[model samples]
Target: MNPPQNPPQDPPQDAQLQADTVWLESIRRRIRSPSQRNPDMSWENNAADLIERQLQYDGHRTWGFVIYRTTYASDADWAEFLRRLRFQMEDMFDYFNGRDILEKFALTVFEDRSLFDGASTDTIRQHFQQWSSTAYRTEQQQQQLEEGSGSGGSAGRVSIGRSPRYRFAVQVDAEALHSVVHDAPAPPELDTTKKGWVKLIDKSWYLGRSEGKSDPLEPIKGVAEEDVGWMKVPYQNVMTEYYTKCRSPNNWSLNYRRPPKVAGSPFD
Candidate 1:
């Protein structure tokens, strides 16, 4: 008699697919209210989907950032914006494997030029500096205390660790913003003229070092403008560059630092 054959089993789910499922579900839950959703919501979701697909097929993991233009009429509006952003970030961290991955991401906000009628970019940057310093100091103190407790050392004697490495968000002048979108060489498919909540992916640009030398931008970047948004960048390259930058003595900076040179052909 012939032995009975076992039934075929389903293939294991791809890790990238599993991560994408979690990410999409988190986004859906957060965007429950119409008032809470923004025009770029679809683009952001598309970007995430594209990133996951690339990871599945090509073993690449691309990161993205959004350029938001806003005009705040009152302090209350600004406060509300900050509250929403904080909650969104918290949700992203929870959904995307926590701070280790998210620490590299950031949102760039450029206020409508009209709002700068009486203010200079320097003034705005200075204000942000003061705010960041106070907020980071408080957070750092708490982190030190927690670490000290875990290590069985006195909180007062805890060694000062490296300053928080990444900025979750930043405000920049029109000139600086132009440098990112227009000045950098982008793929021919990308349209730099587009505005209002633009999400760019896999661009080569970096923050200036403490010595005041900005890392020059490289070419063959990808953009997620309008409806079409897809790109593939190597995962190993991203992490290698991140760790390399983390080793720098003057690693802490106020501006948004770009990821390392992307490997492989442009838009591959």
Candidate 2:
């Protein structure tokens, strides 16, 4: 008898869907296929997988990662950098447009040891020592970490600084761009006409400034009214653009003014 004819081979150009659970729980039973099979599939499978997993596990969320680079020549430059950094931190949690996250994890600053040829990890740690000791591990700061306001463990620690090339990692718990929470806060009342004691209803707007306390207005550092327009910007930003005409080498002037309050309507 002729040798059993081999099963008709799939043409090299034809796509085959092999059953795969290589990413099970990530995607239910999914068909495994070569990228060439669906060259026309326009969607990003990886991103779609992430969205699916986030909704299933993390409960529909979008996260923001803030990263920037700077080279500091002196302590003055470092001080200015910190000033702007603190302002951005406050704005991220306090402003209306900033009320995006459900959580914030940590911020880390790392020195680019690669900038220095043959720089060892020990040398980098030593270079970063001054900042680490002064900022992250003070008695009150440690206490705050214990109390849950600051990042608590080693994960919350800022490792490197005092270097020419510095990179920042600001983590936030902001919503995904496509989430549909039933109780998302309303956009800030853009009607600048009326003014009075408007109670802050959006609890997400405050980071920790008013936590556990019932303050009628959120206790946030105020930015100038004109500066409110800058709220939506975070990633890929030029810090100096916002710092212009604003004092530096001193504190970034965040004169915390409460958002314009509107009188509650009687008809409600």
Candidate 3:
């Protein structure tokens, strides 16, 4: 009888650990490197300038105290808000930069008073001070923020709610602008066309775009009030697969400016 063969063994413990460490480092580098994800990021405008420009816009000056609603618990809510505001600020930069409207447009963030306990310009500036003082604003600049808010007469008041949200005080060519595009339809398959359906294929739900004849049993559009089953999939997962299949890359030609009164206002 032939000798029995042994299965291949994994590397020794130390070797295996080192291999894992190296693999993790590689992933970290890839995530940190903007060029890996956004090819045009090298030429993109820095985020700090974007925030300042947006704050300086005229709309904020005229529309004092634009209140926004939030869902964050009061515990360290300011910190959470700041972190998200930074991300939104980055998005604003990417959107405007892609549209070639860097100078002609601006976007600003306002603190919701419901969360901040009637935070005035000074209160909001103080929060920014804790995290972004040296980077974005100085103590002197707090006064400036007050001047801008007071002069414009537009401060963001806060509201408490289950749905956490923020406001983008958008300005175009020194005018208080909401969005350039108003009520633009969502994904056609999701709204107008009976083309997409949330169907289980291979044990996973998808916002799939149907072909030829539509799936009558699984309609694509939203049903009146309740959350749609397959549409309930996490946004990130849906976008990941959707973008891979239908990658609409941003370029100089894309317009990211949104219309005013895009959603019901808390101020209203």
Candidate 4:
């Protein structure tokens, strides 16, 4: 419901696209052919495991060459890349499994650009330049993307593989939860006691009102820490059911934040 916060800003150079011809070729190969789905491809395999392995082997072989040359890391340094690659892979696997293992893997891999690290900012920018200059390098015909080059935005690297619909599930009314008395305000279930007071029930936030407080004009204790994240927007998408028909007794459970308290008023 909250507007997405802007990510921390990196320098303009960090926004550049990967310009390595070989890497580009490798990506095109995956998107276009999907090797396991094809026959007559020498490296194609049947099992998902085999297909994944082949894709990784070929993809990395091409990418490793481009990364080494573009970043100009020595052979030994590239060899050491294994440590970083393994560590990164472990982190990725911990969060998401196989499909995530495929696309998002590269974006994070290049994040700090150390495996590809070179000199000062100037040289590093130049290193990025080498990868982004597709016109100067060998450019491949993008078949699957018959739409010509993607007008891919800054988050393209990550967004390419993220969920198609909304990434986070929203709940308008979470289960009726009861907590012990502290009497600072009304429990969230008792919405009728107050006016203009709404609960933004992110799971991380507790939605109960003060134990005995009934005044909506007064600020509630559990929610109003100046230090925490507070947001005004409950739903920007008016099309969302949360905005149109968010009420209890209807029993629509999805996108549920917190229901109005079913018990006595907060001050009671």
User: Which candidate tops TM-score?
Assistant: 1
**Residue 105 lDDT in model 1?**
44
RMSD of each: 15.9, 22.3, 18.4, 26.5
Q: Which residue pairs overlap in candidate 2's backbone?
A: 62-176, 101-173, 101-174, 221-256, 222-256, 222-257
On lDDT, the candidate that comes out on top is 1
lDDT of 3 by residue, 1-268 (tens): 9999999998999999999889866665655323322333322232323223333442222111112222233434334333433343345445434323233222234345464543322333334334332322232234446766867853343221110011111111111111111121222112122111111111111233333333334332432212121121111112112212211233101212111211111211
| Runs with alpha carbons beyond 4 Å of true place in candidate 1 | 1-72, 97-119, 124-139, 142-153, 156-169, 172-268
CA lDDT of each prediction against the hidden true structure: 0.35, 0.28, 0.28, 0.28
Give the 10-residue window scoring lowest on summed lDDT in candidate 4: 172-181
Clashes of each: 0, 6, 21, 29
Candidate 4, 124-225: lDDT as tens digits: 334444444441112221321332346542211111111111111221111101111111122222223332121222212223423335434323334432
TM-score of each: 0.29, 0.21, 0.22, 0.21
Candidate 4: residue 38 lDDT (0-100)? 33
The candidate 2 region of ten consecutive residues with least summed lDDT is 172-181
Regions of model 2 farther than 4 Å from truth: 1-70, 97-103, 113-268
How would you encode candidate 2's per-residue C-alpha lDDT over 1-268 as one tens digit per residue?
7887788776454232222323332343243431222222212322222222332342212222222222323445334444444454345334222232323223444435354233322233344444434543342235435556554443244332221112112211112111111122212312122211111111112244344455344322342232221122221121212211111222222422233422122211
